[model samples]
Target: MLVTPVDNSEIVAALDAALDGGPAVLPLSADDPRAGELRVAMAPDEPTLPGTAVVVATSGSTGAPKGVELSAAALTASATATHARLGGQGQWLLTLPAHHIAGVQVIVRSLLAGTPPVLRGGQTFATAVASMTGPRRYTSLVPTQLLRLLDDPVGLEALCSLDAVLLGGAATPAPLLDGARAAGVRVSTTYGMSETAGGCVYDGKPLDGVRARLADGVIELSGPVLASGYRRDPGGTAAAFVDGWFRTTDLGLLAADGTLSVLGRADFMINTGGVKVAPAAVEAVLVAQPGVAEVCVVDLPDEEWGQLVAAAVVPVDPARPPSVAALRAAVRARLGGPATPKLVRFTDALPLQGPGKVNRKGVKDMLRGT
Candidate 1:
């Protein structure tokens, strides 16, 4: 699905055919330099797939090259469950890249609901919402987009007009979530990945038919929404999907009420000396401070501690930013000394990877330079 021009006609047709048990489509961004390599990895030349509908390439981001094979049944289940969870069918606004699973699910939901999505392309938020004709309106966004939009009165109003706003793709700061809801925007925090055909968990609870469990502190998801496993890597599939559950890299705590509180990515934990700390735990404290607009916490190598906690912050006031000592004290006071960032760098904005996700690797590199 080369969506440079936001043309979904061909992609939609392919999806329709796939639903009818046709050849599986490999959705890739035309702008990605890796498209050719990804295409070779997820061979679309196959005449037909017994059950697969789409193969979303999930390489580079994690570790190795592999394709996520989602069956039509899984996609349909996700779309249907989403609609059911969000209180009936509605029009969707495509704000994220079409190649990502989140964006693909928006189109899939629209397709299953028989109501096509309105791509935000180059239009203003108000203009995009005005063009939507569904009785109910909904859109998905990452935390970065939500924070920016909340600062724009028009965007805030446009979001407030929607039936529900799905926020995911990254960890949302407490301030951002509070601000959005305070301004009358119905925000639903989503959790899931391409393995689950998009977000199967919304607002800390699993969608109807979806189940969440913890295996040795790691989050595991199950239900009809799970992908059929990686396309070509059976070993990877076996490692991830065990006993009808898809194991995720995210660590979480499932409450008695079944509400899952994600504790950030297991692989993203920063190890300083002997104690391990979640970057998000420190970010939660730093982001709530007066001058902090956004923050990304990472670990930098150190001769003494082995690893030193570091932070890159985007200040609310660039000229008069919060003092590093004050920020460190705040984190230390709230989360203890090991979680406090020893090195801090201020920037106008955090580097973004996909649509609205902050690029942590890029932030680490920037902090390293300082």
Candidate 2:
């Protein structure tokens, strides 16, 4: 949820009203007009769905909204484990949009801590931290959100005060992580989705009630925290989960220390000539370049290679667009042969869906008929 106020008082009033309904109310962004347009009429004798305290809709960057049913038991288990991991819950500075599971987790964790998270003004992350009512502060942010916060000195300073900062939603840039660590922020990169009740894996470690495994390079999650299953979408539910393990589209590796390192989504794999390549692996290297801020690698049809590996890049330095040859050389230097992108394209910004995830399909279309 993206909270926007036509009047400031209304926002406060809504929060107050929500709190009045329940001391543990999770206040979320109700600003999207489309959210208001959704209507659910109750029947006089309709029975409630079993085990559903809340049903959060998935971000649907890939497809349609998946109503993930979460029981109070599941949410409580997640929040309790999270609190224990962070040395008990403190005042949370809500940053991510409320509609997201990540944002929802903040409220749930705060409620479990017996204190509602404080809402900061929509201006900056630092301001949000400053607005919090007590000590032992925490916040969750996506990589893009974290990058925006880095732009402000005050925000960076405020971030350093947090006990732990959970970062998730997509793969984070290495440079950004380095910047956060350099600033003395307790950053924890997490990996999980709506099905696992937000981030069950924090900083590569699976939390209590969360289990992770890698079978043939694909990440499989099995735990009490996993959603009862994707709501009503049988085909999707069947395709994603098997034998109690949620077969994530994302690929991962289990280190000897038992930490999970998510590689990239298997769906994003591309075939160049006869070799299979993960575009995200290439994008990861591209983003590490001196001038590159963001990047997306996709496979396009080619007369010679069957599929030409191309990179859509957003350079941090506008004056210096990394040339095709330079990018190819960089790829060669970092990851050789099949992993290197052949074509490099400079873009103002990679097409993002809602948050900062690269829209691969959109990028593919953008490169089409060129």
lDDT of 2 at 255: 91
Clashes of each: 0, 2
Candidate 2 residues 1-370, lDDT tens each?
1122223234334333333332122223466454432212111123323555545666566775565656566777887888888887787777766656777777667766766776555656666777776557788888877886787788788988888999988889889899899989899998888888788898899998788998888999988777665545567778887888888888988999999988888877878888988787788788887778878888898988888888888887778776767778888887778878877778787776644566777888877733
- Badly placed stretches (over 4 Å) of model 1 are 1-7, 47-49
Q: In candidate 1, where is summed lDDT lowest over 10 consecutive residues? A: 1-10
Cα RMSD for candidates in order: 2.2, 4.3
Show pairs that collide, candidate 2.
1-98, 1-99
Candidate with best lDDT: 1
Q: How many clashes show up in model 2?
A: 2
lDDT of each: 0.85, 0.72
